[model samples]
Target: MTTLNTHPTTAPATSAAGGGGSLRRVLWAAQILLAAFLLIGSALPKFAGQSDAVRTFTDIGWGQWLRYVTGTVEAAGAIGLVVPRLAGLAATGLIGLMGGAVLTQLLVLEPVWSLLPAVFAVVFAAVAWDRRAESRQVLRSLRRAPSRTP
Candidate 1:
């Protein structure tokens, strides 16, 4: 006669890697990489060449200064995303900042290039949403009463 053990397994299965914490971490890494690329590629150029970047800034007038401000914001947000405690807030700020970028491109001028900022905005928003869900789950688990073993 064989006895069957009904106890739940304590260890997480390797196959579960794609489902929870691993998934969150992977998404965070991708978000950080994308943010860095945007900050470097567009923001850096703006600060490096005020006249050229201001041409794109248009009616805003303070174009040169605005370029510097946007560039600094992007650089800071990029750094924030990599830090464990600040990742969520960083992602949220990124989403808002990118949204403004996309709107500026659309309303100020119908440049085909405007789509790139829009895409980044959407991607960052999705990353923020995912991280928010994970945080909520953690908080919920913490608040729940521990299970009693019979």
Candidate 2:
């Protein structure tokens, strides 16, 4: 379906490719911005052993190792978000991670802390939704690949 733009500043999608391209660009921008914020604000601190990260992990009683692991995953996911084909998978992983964060906050910490992770999860879900076709294609390719068994 083509999208009709009322304003001259934005051109309407003339074909399926054009519509998909426009949508993809929009989703890509959103994913990049979100990934950058997460990587810089959250992942770097954990990797660097910042006081706040240490304190939060200590409070959660999960040990400092989990913080490092979380940081690594976040960094990887953020990197994946910038790759056009990997954005959906990246967002999917982040959604799972954020869901766990939300649960941990709700169970171990105050309710207020849970809100942020919950919000992040929602945004990740949106990215996944927008890239559903690409994600499904990847999955299909994986499923159809020949086994390497000797």
Candidate 3:
């Protein structure tokens, strides 16, 4: 039998525009930076009841409970974004969160503030697209797992 190609069918290692390797590295750097931002800048402030975060959430008028929930989601997503297997999924989830953020800014807050989340959504979308192959593989494996029914 022929040997299977273990490597993903990604772009060439070296190309005219720098290379796929550099692209991957760039993605990794962005992921790490974004993860750190989510954890330190957003999640921690919400959890700590920092004045700015508190006031923003208070203005949202959904109660402090929503702040805790959003923080928890951001914390979990941030952690996932650094994991190779989970990065794509994390980005996918974060995209949804960012979409919610954009809508919240447009509807509840100032419309111009929506630009921030819109930008975040674009980045997360890029990360998600890059990791699509891995995400698909994970889904396939999950589909193949045996049921635990008695």
In terms of lDDT, the poorest run of 10 residues in model 1 is: 8-17
TM-score of each: 0.65, 0.79, 0.84
TM-score of decoy 1:
0.65
TM-score of candidate 3 relative to the true fold: 0.84
C-alpha RMSD for every candidate? 8.4, 7.3, 3.9
Ranking according to lDDT, highest score first: 3, 2, 1
Q: Residue 101 lDDT in model 3?
A: 96
The candidate that wins on lDDT is: 3
Q: Give the per-residue lDDT digits (tens) of candidate 2, residues 29-86.
A: 7788888877999899999999999999999998999999999999999998987567
Q: Residue 32 of model 1: what lDDT?
A: 68
Expressed as tens digits, the lDDT of each residue in 19-98 for candidate 3 is: 46676678888999999999999999999999998899999998999999999999999999999778889999999999
lDDT of 1 by residue, 1-150 (tens): 997764333333222224667776677668768867857876787778756677877665554678778888888787767764455567788888888877777777666767987787777676666656444544566789798999
Report lDDT per candidate.
0.68, 0.82, 0.87
Clashing residue pairs in candidate 2 are none
Residue pairs in collision within model 3: none
Off by over 4 Å in 2: 1-23, 147-150
